[model samples]
Target: MPHSIKRIFTWIFWIFVLWAIFTSPNRAADLVLTIWEIILNGFNAIAVFFDRLLGG
Candidate 1:
């Protein structure tokens, strides 16, 4: 993307995040937890795949 568009998006993202944090902290926390769970699940799946591939 263009630099100007990237900056605009970055600003918008932070603004939304700040708005979420201040307006609905509980929901924000839940969102973060959900994202973390997704990341961990992805890693676990990758590890399992590698283990199976290596016959371990």
Candidate 2:
């Protein structure tokens, strides 16, 4: 049940993100930065998770 809820929310989240990207007037560098932001956010989440596990 919890897994399904997570999946639904994730889908909604990504839909909104994609909408934002398409609606924005952005250059190539802006697109690159958006990609970088996504990658960085993923890395930051991983780092935070590991940091909590290791520190505790």
Candidate 3:
């Protein structure tokens, strides 16, 4: 993408994120928490697989 377009998208994304955060902080927190949990679970699963493969 062009530099100007990229900047516009970045600004728009941040604006939306900020709006969501301010409009409903609890909802935003829950969304972030859920995403974090999913990421952690994925990492945990990968670790378990590696441990099993290494016979640890």
Candidate 4:
């Protein structure tokens, strides 16, 4: 990707982040929590899979 395009995307991302922070902070926080939960659940699933594979 071109440098200009990268900068544009970075600016857009920051703008969106600031917008989320300034507007409906509670909802933004909930979104973060939901994403975190999804990541943790994925890790747990991977651990379970490995455990079963290893005959643990």
Candidate 5:
């Protein structure tokens, strides 16, 4: 993607995040935690798959 487009998207994303945080701090925290757990679970699943594939 073009640098300008990337920058615009980044700014928009940050703006949304700030809006969410300011509108409802608790909801924002829960959203972040949920995202984090999803990412961690994905990583764990990948690791398990690799481990099983390698016969470990």
Candidate 6:
């Protein structure tokens, strides 16, 4: 696999994961604020990964 192709796939995979997490059923009664906080943290991880890849 080429470097550019791998980068593209990585970006796509992270975007898909983020979308999936956001679109998942909201369990308000389970833990209202915690869910969003966790999701945000996951997004932050994704951002950090991409930042490192892109030489931020």
Using lDDT, give the best candidate's number: 1
lDDT scores in order: 1.00, 0.86, 0.99, 0.96, 0.99, 0.82
- For each candidate in turn, the TM-score is 0.96, 0.47, 0.90, 0.92, 0.86, 0.46
Mark the regions of model 3 whose C-alpha exceeds 4 Å error after superposition: none
Which candidate should be chosen as best, given TM-score against the real structure?
1
lDDT of 2 by residue, 1-56 (tens): 69999999999998977877777747645877999999999999999999999994
Q: Write the per-residue lDDT of candidate 3 for residues 1-56, one digit (tens) a residue.
A: 89999999999999999999999999999999999999999999999999999999
Give the worst 10-residue stretch by lDDT in candidate 4: 21-30
lDDT of 1 at 22: 100
Q: How close is candidate 3 to the true structure, as a TM-score?
A: 0.90
RMSD of every candidate to native, in Å, equals: 0.6, 7.4, 0.9, 0.8, 1.1, 11.9
- Per-residue lDDT over 1-56 for candidate 1, one digit per residue giving the tens place of the 0 to 100 score: 99999999999999999999999999999999999999999999999999999999
**Model 2 segments beyond 4 Å from truth?**
1-26
Report the error of model 3 at residue 31, Å. Answer: 0.2
What is the per-residue lDDT of model 5 for residues 1-56, given as tens digits with 9 covering 90 to 100?
A: 99999999999999999999999999999999999999999999999999999999
Q: Rank the candidates by TM-score, best first.
A: 1, 4, 3, 5, 2, 6
Sliding window of 10 residues with minimal summed lDDT for model 6: 23-32
Q: Please give, for residues 1-56, the per-residue lDDT of candidate 6 as tens digits.
A: 99999999999998976676677736433454788789999999999999999999
lDDT comparison, 3 vs 4, better candidate: 3
lDDT of 5: 0.99
* lDDT for residue 52 in candidate 4, whole number 0-100: 98
